[model samples]
Target chain A: MSTKPASERATPWALVTPALLWTLCFFVLPFAAMALTSVTAKDGSFTLSNYAQFFENPSYWRAMVNSLQVTAIVTVVSVLLAYPLAWILAEQVPERFQRLALMLAVLPFWTSYVVRSYSWLLVLAQNGVVNRVLTGSGLFADPVQLANTRLATVIGFVHFFVMLLTLTIFANLKQLSPSYRKAAADLGAGPVRTFIHVILPLTLPGIVVGAFLTFVLAIGDYITPQILGGNNELLMPQLIMMQIGRRGDFPLASALAIILMAVVTVAYLASARWLKIERA
Target chain B: MRAFAKILATVYALLLYGFIFLPVVVLVLFSLQATQFPIPPFTGPSTRWYAAVLADTRLTTGLLHSILVAVGSSLVAVTLGFLSAWGFARFYLPGSAFLRGLITLPLTVSYLIIGMGLLVLFNRVGIPKSLAAAGIGHVVVNLPLCFAIIYSQMGDHQINIERAARDLGASEWKVLLLVTVPVMAPAIFASFFLSMTFSWDEFVISFLLTRFETTLPVEIWNLLRSGLNPKTNAVGSLVFGVSIVLVVAFELLLFRRKQS
Candidate 1:
């Protein structure tokens, strides 16, 4: 593309100014402010006590540990459930019906995400359908406590993330040339071997990208843990919110949020090689 | 063997679909419950709870607030995003790649962090929380999405036509307004529509940034905190219904146009 020589230079910069300024003021400036807030004491003096609190308090540090554990579990379980489903849709289902199948598979995602978590609470409650099924079948004498637990939180996260992983993985699968699969089979590979040695390796980028996204979103979410986890334990986001909501501790919340962001940044770096926004 | 495999695939698909729909099924089914409890022994199908939800003044205000914020923020996001995308696509400015990356950077950050950052910033700046504050947060969240979608659709084919229009003595604004806008309408509309949906359904930012008057999700969350009632179910069902209608309409109208 050729740029016009003189006046057009200013025009392009003028056109871009609003968005650049908006992002700078709202996004970048806030981030800088948060970082500054994180270091400042409540008395308006510089201190490292906020960071110290996270390390010294077991309860606070436990939230970070719990966040990582739950995020890992959700990412792994969602990818496991989603990949085969994506495979089925791409290779097993006929090409024409795939779109409809995929849409139906993910249709429930259109519901409000907060509402979705709340709905899961109902479904997993003592008198809910799962318990009723278990007791009705004489498998147990009483309902197992399902709602307001880590298990419930995981279920909610996985349910939503499975849809996302399936979408990414399915797109990746569709992009593979048929000749690759044919060659794998012709090279004396069975279906399992072909998938393991050929297809899975090729689709690893999609899996990594989706899994990393799941990690970032799941860790940062306040709703799923708050509504489902029942405060039995806190996650990083909940702890961060509690600081601001109840205590009016903006400094602590800023510190906690920066910590949470740091975790996401580390995850991004680990998966950065495979991550790209452009559809391949 | 092939028949067995087909049967297994069908069963797997059915099971997954069942898992996906179970919560929503329980949600809608319990919304019609005549009794207080949302579980055990399906009761008389009643619209009483739905009536209660509609009558709630706070919730109705929240619904309106949600619409206002979603529309207002999405308009800002899409407009700013479109202008920047056009500028970047049209020009070879210094560090253009780095600048574009800076604009797109927030897509990686979580809304909780974004909200927390803004909450801290607003406190430092002495800005009070309001619907406008929440709307500003929404713009921060949605702007990157709008930029990426609009940016991706700005192909050289459209640029050539835009140049032709400019050569015919159209001013920059005129060419942009008359030609580029029409050409990129699909992407623009899609991004706008998508940003609206995200903003409408968004929870955390509005929850953190707003005071008494807030968006629907935050209000519904408050209702949930008060107690587990069928009214919450009714509200969720209502949101689900409206969202489904909009999505289906978008599919039929906008996406179909793109396909053809």
Candidate 2:
């Protein structure tokens, strides 16, 4: 690069300064503040007791375990449910109708997310549709408990995320050249074999990306658990919120948040390779 | 076998569609209940809950607050994003990659963490939680998204037109205002709309940062926490209705342009 005049050099700085300052003040500074707070003790001494409490307490660890358990269930279930739906739309639906079909599929996503969760709470209640159908059809001896459970929470999550995964996986499936399938058939691979060997591997990136999104969102969510999961159990977000909301304990909340972030970091590192763009 | 497979796929698609729409269907259905509880056995179709929701001062005011925060924050975010994106795309700035990464990093972090971080910082700095604080949080969450969208669309193709304008004796301001802004209008609009969508629906940050005047989501949360009532359903339905209108408008207007 040639040497530029001072004024010319400052132009980019001037343009970018406002955004950078905002990011620095709000995003970076607060994160640093949280990091600092995480290591501080309640008694005004520098101690890792906040983190120690999380490491030491069974209940605290249980909150993490519950979060992981629910998030894992939601992600895997969403992927499983979404793959075939995406495949059908990609392969079966005519091109003319595919866009319309996809639009309809994700239409519920337009609704407020909090409202949707609350809707699920009602839908899964004892006298809600599922139970009513079961009893009305004599499929069940009596109404079984469904509301305010891990199953309900997972169902609510899977509902929202399945649409997300379908979109990602549908894009992945559509990106496949028909020649890949044709070539596989020419090489004596059956439909299943072609799908397993060629299609699945190709779409893995999309699935991973979508699943990663689900993991992050579901784990950090305070609403879904607070709404549907009920007070029976606590997820990481709930625990973090509980610390801040009930106790006004910033240090403990910060520690829990950092731990949660560390989990997401581990997840990101694992999926980083697949997420990278190919230059070609 | 072919017929059977086709039938199977059709059934599966229908089932999935039903599953996807079930909650929304229930939400709308029960929003009309004459009964107090929003759940179970169909009651009389009543418009009273909707009326009640409209009449409720807190919910109505919260809706206005949501609109204000969403529009206010989105404008700030989009302006900042557009400027930075233009600068990075056009200029030869050192460490630009690092700076862009810094701006985009918040997209990876959860909104809850961002909210918590802001809460801690605000507490430490003695900045009282208010609508402005929540708006700042919204900007923090949205700025990255807007920046990424605009930056991605800032291709080299536009540079030629910009250079032509500069050669015609247009200053940097004139070039940006007339040439660059017009060319990048689609990206800017998309970013603004997307930012609006996110900020409108966003909860935790606004929930934590604001106390007396909160956003619609937090208000709905308050209603939900108070008890299970059809009025909550009515409010949910109302938001859903407005969102659908916006979405349809976006599809017909913006999406058609993209396709063309």
Candidate 3:
């Protein structure tokens, strides 16, 4: 690179300084503060008991287990449900209506996020739509307990993420050149073989990106579990919220948050190769 | 075999669509129930709940607070995002990639964690929880998104125009304001709109940072926790209706202009 004068070098810095300062003061500083608090005890001495509490307590560790299990299930189910729908839209739907179809798919996403979860509560409640249908159709003799269960929580999450994954996977499918299909056919591969060997692998990056997002969001969410999970089991977010909201226990909350962040960081590093923001 | 495959795909798509629309459809339908509960056996198609929502001063005040925070946070986020995006794209800076990564690192972290970190920091610093504090949390969440979107759209085509403006004896500020900003208006608008959408809908940060004077989502959370009422449904349906209008307008005005 050619050497630039002092004024030229200073201009870029001037332009960038406000953002850097904001990120430093708010983002980085807060993170450091949290990390510090996570190690500090309530009595003011530095201790790792806040984190050790997570390891020693059965309920605390159980919340982590529940979070991971639900997140994994939601991610897998959403992707499985979304991929075929994305394929149908990109491959079989007429071109002129594709935009409309895609818009409809994500339209519900514009609803209030809190409302969306509460709405699912209504749909899965004891006297809600599904239960009413079962009883009316004589499929069951009694109304089932659907609301306030892990199943309801999973249903709410999968509903949201299926829409997200569809958008991503649909974009990936559309990016494929028609020639890939033609070449496969010419090389004697049928439609199923071509899709299995060529299309699915090509779209894996999109799937991984969507699934990673689902995992992070679902794992850290408090509302879906707080509203729908019905106190049957605790998730990490709910446990963290309880510490601060009810007990005024900042140290424990901070420690739990750090642990949750560590899990998300691991998920990110696993999917880092496929998650290129510039290219995406 | 081909026809069978097409039939199977059609049935599957319909089922998925049904699943997707079920809750929303139920939400809207029961929002009009004349009865107390927002559940089954539709009663009168009443306007009582909607009237109740409009009459409630708490809900109305919360709506205004939400709009204020969303607009204020989004503006600050977009301005900082646009300037930094321009700098990174136009200039050659050492460790630019690393710095950019640092700025965008929050996108990978959960909102709950970010809210917790801010809560801890604020508690230590004696900064009382308020709408302004929540707005800062929102900006922290949104600044990265704005930066990424605006940065991606700054391409080489705009560079030539900027260089030409400079060679014509325009000042650096003048060239940027007159030439570069004009060309990047589409991206700027997109980022601002997107930021507004996120800040408007964001819940966790606002919930954690605000006390009594809170945003609509927190207020709605209170309402939800209190009981199951058609009033909550009415407020939710109202929000959904307004959001749909804005989204449609964005799609028509911004997206169509860009496409053409």
Candidate 4:
């Protein structure tokens, strides 16, 4: 490409200015404002009281812990279910079937996330499909209380997200050469050993990327837990919503948002490191 | 051994497909169930919920608002994305790598943060959070995706062709209008459709920003919070039906093009 003259240089800037300004005004400035609001006291004094409250209060701590616990469980389950499915799609499928399989993998992602979560609500409610099946099969005498439980929330998260994880991992798998697997097989390594030594290490970057995405999304989700989680399983996003909507405590919500941002940033940094190492 | 592996793969594929479609199947089936409960012992099929959903003027208006926003945002996003991608592809700009990274960084940020951040910014700037503000926020969130798609498609071959056309005395604008743009049509179309889908389905930002004219997902959220109703399923089924048709049509068209 040739360099443009100084007069022409303004063209790219002109083209990019709207998007740049949008991001600056909408994305960068608001977070800064939110951070500022977090430290500002109700009486107009700068104070660390909001952070202190968040840390000192057992309910806040419990909410954070529960959010982390649910995120971890969902991440693991999504990966576990997605990996085998990705492997089968990548290694075992015929070329002609690949596109269909990949399309199937991405279809769930195209649906509205809230609608998908609501579908789970309908499926896991006390008289929902799972209980109906269980009772009708004579496995239970009555419908199971599945909705509003921790189990229901986790199940919803996995159901909604596992397809995305599979697609990411499958993309990574497709980029790997088949010869490595063939060489391991020729050396008499079984499928399990081959996967453990060869495929697993090679695909770690995708795993890291997928897991990070799933965890961040799962933790940031307010709607899923708000709809699916009963009283006992309140998560951080829901807590932030409550502060903002119910209690009208913008400072507390802003403080909690900052904390959530920090946690996400830390997790992301760690995952980036693992991804870089895997790539190396 | 190969046959057995093929069988296993087929079974896995079936299961994966089942996973994707299960909820949709359940929603469609239960939308017609006479029993208010989601339990599978269906008394009979019923269209009462669909009638109820059609009767709700708020939801219908919300759907219309959603369509308008999606179209407006996608157009803005794609136009911006095309310009930025062209700059990156055709110019030797400084800090291009950093610019690329910055463009894509929004994908990592949660919608919750984006929604809150936009709300605060709009509030400070006296933008009066409305449908336009929501559209602007969506464009920001979607621009990176559009840029990525367009940038990837503006490959070396396409760039070289455009350069050749320019060297033959064609103006920069003419080259873009005649040669480069046509070559990148499929990518532009795909990105447009994707942006439309994203903006249409977006919840958090619209929910946060819209005071009067809420988008479909926001309306759906409000309805869900009020109470669960079969009417919600009717609306969902309509959305799902439209999306499935569009996606399937696009898939078939793309497949045929690839084959040809």
Candidate 5:
């Protein structure tokens, strides 16, 4: 790859220069500032105070734990709901319906995330539609206080993410040969056995990727929590937002952001390793 | 045996579809509700909120600002992305993989972080936060997406075609303009539309980076935070409607091209 002529080499660099410059100016430089800010003190000198503040505080650690918990719950729920839907879309549906279904799945993502979160707020508020219907239909005696709870955050995350998971898994499933299933059945494997032994293993890569993607988005999400979590929930991203905007504590916010980046990076690395294992 | 699986599949599909569309349905319905609260006791459908939204000068100005920024940023980003992608595809370069990774790194970072980083950098450079800065911020965020889309579409054939053109006595610039670009037109168009959508819909950077000149989403956020109003719903519906139309138009054009 490196044996190319100098003129040849200049072309690729020329092509990449604009993109590289954009990243350097906006992405790399900004992050470098953020990292510097994270370590800087109120006295305008370099210090470990921000990191110390984040690590020493139980509430900060609690927010991190809460982020992980919510992300994990959403990832699990999304996968559980998405797997069946993906299978249906990939296998049972006709081609025309499949395209329509896939479009419908992705269409919601095109809308404003804030608008979507607000819709959830409307649906899950005490006298919101879900409770109103439940009470009207005699399903529940009282309206559930569903908003601002951890449950609401998790539900919103699942709602926002399940589509992406289904799409990923569906794409993976579409590539599998149908003959493999038929072959399994002919060899005396029942539907359940064939699905478990054959289909499940093959789709593991999609599951891992889908799960990681969902988890990453969920963990990094601030808008959903701010709108839906009301006064109670204080996730990591929300904490970082507060530190930066409300509290005007740039150092603390930078520290919190770095922590979040580290955690998400670790999770992504683990998922990448898991994907390798699945492939092997 | 297949009957049971088919039944299960239908049920799953319906449930999934319901989950995806439920919020959108609610949004459209609630936009029409006379009551301030999203839950409806059925007062009656009215265009009162739409009237209110139309009357708000701030929201109108915000919408105009959003359109300008989205258009400006997307145009710059897509053009640069196209040129860079052409360079990469035509020229053999060391560290191309590293370059690709660097381009994609922004997508991984939270938008909030990006916003913060940009804010800090702009502050250091003594550039006041404004609409122009916000547009630049959006360009940074979207450039990678445009590059990836264009580069992938350029494909392996781009190198051969460029080489052939050059060997056939075309200048480097001429080969790029004539041979490389024409072939990558669809990808370029796709990148433009994608970048437009991204810039149009982006909220966080625009929200953080602007003071007086805000985008549509920032206006929507302010309205939502201050109070629940029908006007907000009206604006939401309008934005959603426009995006849907644009997406459908693009899809139709692409589909027709595929058929022909």
Candidate 6:
């Protein structure tokens, strides 16, 4: 392949150039522009005021705190909820039905993301079905406030991420040969012990990957918080959106976005230590 | 005891399924509501909201814009991704691994951050917010996915075929267009389909990058902010319906062929 003619030597470069250039111009350059803008003040002077503002403002820093809390909650809850479901699909369901079950599990993911949150809003509204059910079934005295709260945001995030984590964990569970389980049983380990020691340890990488993905996506998201969360409390994305949408403050927004990116990078590094983070 | 555990597992699975599908069920059921509110009371099933959604020019235009952006961006993303994937697979280049990683670096970043970066860059560069700008952002997000998918599928088998074609005196362009592409059609098509779906449903980038003539998700967001109406549910159900059809069709047409 390296012994190509002079005219053909540049073919690979030509083939790859468009994508490289596109990524450079649209992705890399824009990111560079954003980083530069984050450090520049309104008057075009170099300043750390935008970054400093996040530290000085309790409300702004509170958004970051809120984001981390919500993301951590969503990641942990989704992984817990999804593991059993993934196990059921992988181990209990007949092999022929596994694909269909997995597809059904993730079916709602195809819904427009905005609409997914809105649907949750409708379901959790004062006059919504959940309220009607609780009231009708005598589960509660009245329709509890479910929508337009941090609870609603967490629920929305968890709902989406459960489907996602289930897929990853399911794939992980499927890849495990029956030999491991058989070997555990042959060694006099009970079902619970086998699962606890062998299965759980084997799937930790998949769990970590899915949990990290849930953390990154749930933290940076704006729609679920905006639609389902109402204006009760702000998250990092909501705070960044506020800077741009309300005040047209790009510097401040960039600073917040960089901070968010930094957090995600830290998460990726943490997770990568446990998992190889390889690409085929 | 085993039977009781089995029954419990079945019940758990059913409950989980119910929780997962609850919002979608509510959304679709309310989309057919005869009245104003999309909330409960089990109103008469009617297509009136769907009719209203179709009637609204803003939504209809937004739908077309979404289709255009999704198709156009996905096509470009797939093309560039395929070419680059072939280049790196077929030919050795200096620092290729680093270059490939650089191309895929966007995959780790959040879409909100990507959108924000573009918004600031476009603002400074005086590029007015439009569908094109949004499409560019969509390409940025989808290109890495396309690259990874297509690159992974470019195994030794395809290279062997390409070598055979070249040995048979076929020109480079001829081999790529006739031999390499057909062999990689399934991968290319899969990447294109995935890219289209991502671009179609992408919200944050389109939200930040477009103005008056925005995409459907942005339009839907406006409808949501304006008020809760059955129209939003109707449109949502419509999108869901269309996406399901596409997924089923792809599964049948592509996966079935591959399996056989």
Counting clashing residue pairs in each candidate, in order, gives: 0, 0, 0, 0, 1, 0
Clashing pairs in 1: none
2 against 3, candidate with superior DockQ: 2
Interface RMSD of 1: 0.8
**Regions of model 3 farther than 4 Å from truth:** A1-5, A273-280
**Top-DockQ structure, candidate number:** 6
Q: How well is candidate 1 docked (DockQ)?
A: 0.86
Model with the higher lDDT, candidate 4 or 5 = 4
lDDT of 4 at A52: 98
Residue by residue across A1-280, what tens digits does model 2's lDDT show? 7787888778888999999999999999999999999998766679898899999999999999999999999999999999999999999999999989999999999888899999998788887888989998998989878888999999999999999999999999999899999999999999889999989988887787888999998999999988988889989999999999899899999999999999999988877764775211
Kindly report which residue stretches of model 6 are placed more than 4 angstroms away from their true locations once superposed: A1-3, A276-280
Candidate 2 has what TM-score? 0.97
lDDT of 3 by residue, A1-280 (tens): 7787788789898888898888998999999999999898767899999999999999999999999999999999999999999999998999999999999988899999999999998888888888999999999999999988999999999999999999999999999999999999999999999999988877887788788889988998999999999788999999999999999999899999999998888888767854674246
The per-residue C-alpha lDDT of model 3 at residue B169 equals 94
Per-residue lDDT of model 1, residues A1-280, tens digit only: 5756677668999988999998899999999999999899867899888988899999999999999999999999999999988989998998889988998888889999999999998889888889999999999999999988999999999999999988999999999999998999999999889999989988887788888889988999999999988889898998998998899888888888888888888788767844553225
Q: What is the TM-score of chain B in candidate 5?
A: 0.92
TM-score of 5: 0.94
lDDT of 5 by residue, A79-119 (tens): 99888888877777788788877877778877777777777
Chain A accuracy as TM-score for every candidate: 0.94, 0.94, 0.95, 0.93, 0.93, 0.95
Considering TM-score, where higher is better, how would the candidates rank from best to worst? 6, 3, 2, 1, 5, 4
- How close is every model to the real structure, measured as TM-score? 0.97, 0.97, 0.97, 0.93, 0.94, 0.98
Residue B207 of model 5, lDDT score = 75
Tell me the DockQ of each model, to 2 decimals. Answer: 0.86, 0.86, 0.85, 0.59, 0.65, 0.89
Per-residue alpha-carbon lDDT of candidate 6 for residues A134-193, written as tens digits (9 for 90 to 100): 999998988999998999999999999999999999999999999999999999999889
TM-score of chain B of 3: 0.97
* Positional deviation of residue B113's Cα in model 4 after best superposition, in angstroms: 0.6
